[model samples]
Target: MFKYLKNDIPASIVVFFVALPLCLGIALASDAPPLSGLIAGIIGGIVVGFFSGSRLGVSGPAAGLAAIVAAAIGTLGSFELFLSAVVLAGAIQIFFGVIRMGIIGYFFPNSVIKGMLSGIGIIIILKQIPHFFGYDSEPEGADSFIEKSGETTLSALAHITDNITLGSMIIGIVGIVIILFWDNILSKKHAFFKILQGSLVAVVVGTILQVVFSSNEALKIESLHLVQVPAPEKLSNFIDYLSFPDFSQIFSKDVVLIAFTLALVASLETLLSVEATDKLDPEKNVTPTNRELFAQGFGNIASGLIGGLPITQVIVRSSANIQSNAKSKLSAIIHGFLLLISVLTIPMLLNHIPKSVLAAILILVGYKLAKPSLFKKMFSLGWTQFVPFIVTILVIVFKDLLWGISIGLVIGIIVILVKSYQNSMFMKISEIDAGKTTKLVLAEEVTFLNKATIQKELFNLHENSSLELDIRKTRYLDYDVVEIIEDFLIQARNKNIHVHLLSERGNVDNPESFIEFLKLDKIKTNETN
Candidate 1:
């Protein structure tokens, strides 16, 4: 773990900076105490990080679950009751992991996965627009297009002109410039620059600018526009911030329903985030999905026991970790440690950080995830891949992550069925002396989905024609397809069409039961009829 300290430490610092505002924002979005987000972040980073097989994924209170959390808190009558649900949710997630249900992540198409990341990137950038321009009406990590502030993603931009703060905007602009310069020029020139990290530098500069503008009322950023780290005032007083779940309510029906919902959402978000993070990792390391589910389960349980919001592997922070060049799980753990230490020790200083600065940093992160090149690359892969990829991004930007992914999955399935229908078999025609011959070659691993297409071809074969049916390359031909061929053979003899069956064993002249024939081992044949 210490082997890549140089890389991991620097990356962890960058992730720490990225996660700071996110923790507070997501909590606010969920209508929970800001400290709850911090607590979840701590557990996600430390507990989940330690147990997770993913080297780069960062977990925390995700914006994706903010709506459910907000509603759950309201429905459950008290935050304590909600905490009970969170604990139950964690137990449910653990059961899911033990059952190896993490395989659900594998069923998602590659196009849909790429679309998910790109869609998230677009959402991040869109949501951050108000923050970047110094409008703090919306939370930092909101996942939906329509925000709690009563504005859609694009509609909110209209209010920016009236609500934008000059001081925050100035710092945000400078931060973006600094990050761009540091990433493209300075870091490439010196090892020192790499150690400091562009985002960290931007955060420092933004804080300094906040202080510089303290004396100027015309340009001063309001407290609402800055990072709102909770200040406990004393070491002993910090204990009051921690609260345990009211386990008495854990068995209630409302609590049970909320717990199930939280478990399913959190588990899915974690699986998808880990998958996306593995893709973003420069080294292309694979994360164990089942292990990730287990890690998140424990993390959520710990968070709930200590009064934190529900947790998941947050892609925004995870992507930031990957972009920061994190080398191992150590980076995630270090970031968690830093969040705990900073929230407890130097929160006042952290509070001085302008939300706009973090917005600038996230804009960079979003750009990286949804670069124009990614669109072009997906497009070149053809409509089968690109259609689902593009659709996922659009839906995510307009609706939410879950809806967008669900839509993309449906589209991907349709594309698969279409492709299967088109390529189920190969057919050709030959004629000599007024006698016509048809050649039908079945595809490898033909399934029931191909039955209709194969049936259509056989139905079109003319009477008094010679037919050559080839299965030499076929493997695992579906029973449905075999029945179609068997029916066609019976029709051919009555239709007076001579047939030559081809397989590994040899040629057969319209041979008997296809069911019994298929019971034989797959054989190769070259003999002619």
Candidate 2:
């Protein structure tokens, strides 16, 4: 850990700046106290950092769970009651880790996973656009396709003229231009650009612009968003922000149900982020998923105890950490410390940093995750992969992130089932001496689902042909498939082809019904008999 700290310390500062607005934004979206998100980010980074086996994984309050958290607060009648559920969720995640359920992430199809990443990337970009123009009606980086302001993400963009702030827009455009210039040109110069991070430079510029514009007061640039860190005059005054759970609601069945839902969703989000962040890492080091869950459990417990939102390994923050060149868990720890220090000491300075700068940074992060090259790569994998992938993206863009993923997963499962049904049964026919002799082999197991494939294989037999169907090893044959086989026999007769059945247990007691059969002898049977 100490060895990793050399590079990680500076990286943490980058992650800290990136995480600050997100923490407040998500907390505001969830309708929880603005400080709760910060508390979660701090605990997730500092506490989980110590226990997590991941080098690049950064944990925090996730946007994926914001709707759930918001709804939970309403259902539970208080934010404190929701905290109780968060605590329960942590315990549940710990149970999952103990049971080694982390392997569940492996079962997710690659196409769906890629689709999820792309969807989230698109969402991040869309959500930040409004913030870039200094529209503060909605929280920054909210991913739901249906905007909180009652319109689609794209529509909100079209209506941006109504809510635009000239100052923030200017700062945002300048920040984007600087980042692009530094990344695309100056960084290659191998001079001062290497010493000065592009994003850091853009943020500084944005901050300076904000101060200058605010001082002038003549431009009337209203709606500029900033990080609002609650200040306490004394240590005792800080206690007002602390929230306690209402244990009286613990026994309610509704509370238990919501608690379990939170656990499940939070666990899935954490697992997904764990996988995604590992892929984003430049080192390509894999994090132990079970260990990650255990760490998340502890982090969530602490977060809830301190009146914070439920914690997960958030992909947005983790990606920022990776892009920032975070080297180890130390980066996560340091960022958490930065959160504590910034909120406690320099909140006024934080309040001065314009939202557009953060939006520009997130826009860059979004581009990296949803590059056009990714779409081409997915298409090259074929329709079996592309169908679900595209569907997931559309669903996410049109509906919600969770809904899109669920749709993709269902489609993926259906594709697998179709392939399995076709492959489970097979028939092969070969013609010798120009179709005089042929061989037909029944598959190991022929079920009703395989009737179409089997029928197609049998109908292709040649006229005046001698064929052999070997089914001696087959243990089970459904009646629907048997009927198809019998129908094929009739068709073969009309075509002047000989069909031979390979079976020892062909009692065929019910001549009209193909399913009827009994084993009179213990010996195996085949077409040779």
Report residue 440 deviation for candidate 2 (angstroms): 5.5
Per-residue lDDT over 346-455 for candidate 2, one digit per residue giving the tens place of the 0 to 100 score: 65676666777767876776677689999998999898899999998888667655677789999999998787586755555565777765555555565778887778
Best candidate, lDDT-wise? Answer: 1
Where is model 1 poorest over a 10-residue stretch in terms of lDDT? 520-529
Per-prediction TM-score: 0.82, 0.75
Candidate 1 wrong stretches, greater than 4 Å: 1-34, 53-89, 136-153, 243-288, 309-334, 432-434, 510-529
Clashing pairs in 2: 502-526, 502-527, 504-525
Error at 374, model 2, angstroms: 3.3
TM-score between candidate 1 and the true structure? 0.82
Q: Candidate 2: misplaced stretches above 4 Å?
A: 1-34, 62-85, 136-156, 186-197, 218-224, 243-266, 276-286, 314-331, 421-430, 434-448, 459-464, 468-529
Q: Model 1 Cα displacement at 455 (Å)?
A: 1.6
Give the Å shift of residue 185 in candidate 1: 2.4
